[model samples]
Target chain A: MHISLKPELLFNLGSFPVTNSILTSWIGTLLLIVIAIVVGGNFKRIPAGIQHVFEMVYEMFEGMATEVMGAAGKKFVPLLATLFLFIITSNWLGVLPGVGSLGIYETHAAAPAKDTHAAPAKDAQAKPAAKDAHAAPAAKDAHAAPAKDSHAKDDHGPVFVPLFRGANADLNTTFALAIIVMVIIHVMGIKSAGLSHHLAHFKNPLEIVSEFSKILSFGFRLFGNVFAGEVLLTAMASIFVIITGNNLLAYGALGGFIVFPFLMLEFFVGFIQAFVFAMLTLSFLSLFYKTENSEPHH
Target chain B: MLESLGINPVLMLAQAISFGLLYYVLNRFLFSQIRGALEERSAAVSKTLADKTEIEHRLQAFEQEQKAAQKKVAEEVQKMMLDAKDAAASTKAELVAKAKDAADAEFATAQKRIEQEKVAAEAEVSKHAKTLAQSIVQQLLSEKASDPQWQQEQIKASLESLKQSKS
Candidate 1:
């Protein structure tokens, strides 16, 4: 119900405004690092223990690369692997309790309120009504912090803005990933096929035209999946509270039944979106290579 | 205000930089090691297979050589046994013939000696008969003054007896 298109800005690092999504990505990066070190530290030639699991994951991407690129596909494994691992982990970060839930709230006086108010008109009317009931009687700071017993008895705590948001849910992260993929693909193509041959792909103006669509498709697809999932879960939680009218019952229903299933569903979606993005990149890379090779035949 | 969901260039650049960093770090940590292991494993497997085939070939050749040596020894032993049998048979025949020749010579010598001894005894007996007859004739002559015809008749009869014995 508190759906915002942009990730909330947590703090400013010099001129760079670091958002909650960036924070979550940093978490994902840290998680990946710890696992890599732990797994890499004990790396054995025989590939037993965690190394085995790591190898399986590594091999999965290798197979995808090989499927499209044949023996030459092995070269792209690292890039594809990094993409899948980072995206999937960042996507799943949304489901954590404090991830989208706890934050330093910067309340935009006009916009946030309008989004909450406009929620009913666009989608379900009662959804925002339920969110309002869940948020607080006061529009702004009542949910920001736990104040006093006098205020606690009157209403539920302050409406919180999360300090950490799902990285994939943010346009910045998805677009960045997509742009990076395109850049890598183009670079790889140029490296393999030479600059002239690579540019020949846009000989048809339509090909040039499609590149824009490609960006939208790739970035938006990932962003939509992850962002909508967060919205879906938050809405589902609010729905239960609204229906039950008892805070405890709603929390139980959200945590126990409705949200739990959706959370599990989101995990698979996260993995699948990651897989799709990586595979698409690999496929594009393979196509480039294929043409690069076939052009000689032509 | 940057629209919340709208793409931000600065943020996108930031994310790109982060992604690039992640890619570099991850490649160093995981991908390189796994790839090296994979290549090493492949090489090892192929090497093992090659060595196995080579060993099998050597074993087969060795087995063939062993069989040939065993066969040659068996043939030599068979030849030696046949030679021994032939030598033993020839030696047995020679010993039998030598014994037969010795026995024949001894029998011929014994026969000659028997014949000589028989002749000698007969001659001695004849001599004794002639001497006894002469003595009888002299005694008769003295008694009858002269008996030449009686003595001649006795000598003729003895000579006839000797002739019959000789025949």
Candidate 2:
């Protein structure tokens, strides 16, 4: 089973190396835009079919916004709804049969060398004490073996790079979403409470830390959930393949039995995570705006 | 760590731009229109409700007016009927009294005429009787010229009957 923390680079458009997750997100954006155009182009007083579904989603989010922010919440519906749609679509698209599985076998040499250099640093940062104590020799041994091999073979080994990955699985996309939401929240706060009042919240260092933590939590929570779901599905499918002794027919027949439930679980998790993300943003917005009323009641 | 996880600033910026575009499109097309439609529909509904209430009130007022008019008409009709009855009664009484007075006057005139007729007839009868008695007395006196004692006796009997009748 192959799992990568980073999305596979599909191709470059000029200097921008478009990754699989970016491509998937573009597809999601296109899908949403088309839906919006279709639904928005010919709105009926009496909604039907896809229009009805869209209205239902609009109403649901509007109701949630109202519940969170009262009348003012309505203004934030577009952002929150877009976030929900974009995230959920990306997540569900990630789990499609071909998304993670369908790929080209490119040699590792085609991959960026930067990823290799960054991996050890990331590992060291993630487990500094453990790496320094227990895993130091093991890490050296791993590097030594790769070094012992003819560098060309080790570097040019064929790697399966999927054409599409879940958009939220990429930290860039989630972080982008998080940053956008946080920035908007602050802007709204400043607009409503004045710059001085809005900035005054940072008087407490904990509050400053909280603001940064909010971004991290928002981004990682979504990325982790979607990425973990993908991993779980991959692991389950691989386990099925191993159990079937690499027999394609047996794998196909038994894979459903093992992986189908997890697929359903992934679907549930995708929707819940999307809802949670949007809800938390709404809650934070309400909380941030409520600072005006935060004075101690005498 | 971020680089290892492929958190490119350009990609992040691009995603944010994409999201911003989506928000703009959705806000412009879907949300604004729906909100407007909902507001318009609600306004129309409230207006229709207000109109309905106004119509109901007017209908109630019209009904009350109709009822009052009907009552007034009934009362007027009753009053007119009573007046007509009273007029008819007075007219009938006046007619009856006039009829009674005319009948009494005719009776009195007839009674006076009858009395005059009866007096005339009585006077004629008495004159005729007197004339017949005188004729019979003259004949008896002529037949009894030779009988002076019989004539004296007839005269005496007439005188005695006259005196007895007078008494």
Candidate 3:
């Protein structure tokens, strides 16, 4: 069971570093596109088949949003709906067969790339929680990188690098989503309620601090929940391997019997986290609209 | 680990851009179209329902008018039949009265003509009897010396007998 605090670098795109989370998220986006096409493409006035299912789901969310946000919710439905789909799909992406488990080994020379690639390895070794993750994949690694003798020089040899990771599991992606949500909320507040009214939400010092803290709260809440689920599943898988004396058959049995259950848990966790995030944003936005529309308290 | 898993500035911005783009594109393509189509269709359906109700109301009213018109026509036909019957009854009564008057007049006229003819016939009979009596009397006088009183008595008795016969 490997658990890293940070997402591993899958490959380099010229100068920019592409993390595994980014890859998975892109795949999630592509999947969303495909879903949109299948659901919304051959749409009719009267729906049937896949279109019916899609419309039903959309209407459900729309109804909920309208219930919460009232008339303004009619406009904000797309935002909430998109967030739910994106987060839920990306969260569930980790549960696929070989998400955190399988990957190519990134074995570049530690000396040359060490300065540029300090983020992943350095962040991993620095964190106490990442110690187990570092140790678990190191022993089972195959020498896929160019040089084998060069690995013996450093304390760390080739590390198992997964091609994709859950986007919600990465703190970076979740934080980004959180920040974007906050910015949108504030902007919408200013737009709906005027700048003075929106700014007045921070009348007290503690209120201002609390509002600012929402950035980290929103980001880490999603990141921690999803990442913890990932780590738990990985740890359970590892325990299965250790118990079965590294037998592949026993591992499968443990997975089907035990690990599979947590995967289901993770699935729920993913769905719930997505729901919470979107709903929180929706509720918060609703509040902003309410505050904006209501008479000012002297 | 929490420190490492914490938010990063650069990555947060990147994700923000990604989310924004995805939201914008999806909203434009998928959701807006759904709302538009759904709203338009519902409006059309309601409009059609309203139109249907209106047409039904009109049909009911028209049917009611047709029924009233039919009733009126039936009543007129019955009244016309009654009027024709009354006219026929009155004409029959008048024709019967006229026919009875014409028969009475014809009978009266025929009675008057019979009386006149009877009077004329009696006068002619009287003249012929007078001539026959005179001739008889002259022949008797010539035969047995002038018996005027007896001829007169015979003539009076014959005339009396003729009157009794006529009665």
Model 1: pairs clashing at backbone N, Cα or C within 3 Å: A5-B4, A5-B5, A6-B4, A6-B5, A103-A163, A142-A158, A143-A158, A143-A159, A144-A158
Ranking by TM-score: 2, 1, 3
Predicted candidate 2 versus true structure: per-residue lDDT over A159-275, tens digit per residue = 445567799999999999999999998998888788997898799999999999999999999999999998787666556444433434444445546777888899999999999
Give lDDT tens digits, candidate 3, residues A112-229: 2423332245223322223223224533442233222222344355556666688988888888887778888889888888899888888899987877798889988998898898
Question: What lDDT tens digits, residue by residue, belong to model 1 across residues A1-298?
Answer: 3456777655567777777788889889888877887777777888887778768778998887766676778888988889998998898777664566544333344223212222222122222223333332222333333442111333343334555689998998998888888877788878888899889989999987787778889989999999898877666655654455445534533444556677788889998999999988887777666443443111
lDDT of 1 by residue, B40-133 (tens): 9879999999999999999999999999989988988887888788777777777777777777778777887777777877788778877887
The TM-score of predicted model 2 comes to 0.68
User: How does each model score on lDDT?
Assistant: 0.71, 0.75, 0.71
What TM-score does each of the candidates earn? 0.67, 0.68, 0.66
Task: Chain A TM-score per model, please list them.
Answer: 0.78, 0.81, 0.80
What is the docking quality class of candidate 2? Answer: medium
Looking at the true structure's interface, with contacts defined as alpha carbon pairs within 8 Å between chains A and B, what fraction does model 2 recover? 0.75
Candidate 2 lDDT, B16-88, residue by residue in tens: 9988888888778877777776678779999999999999999999999999999999999999999999999
Residue B18 in model 1: lDDT: 80
Chain A TM-score, candidate 1?
0.78
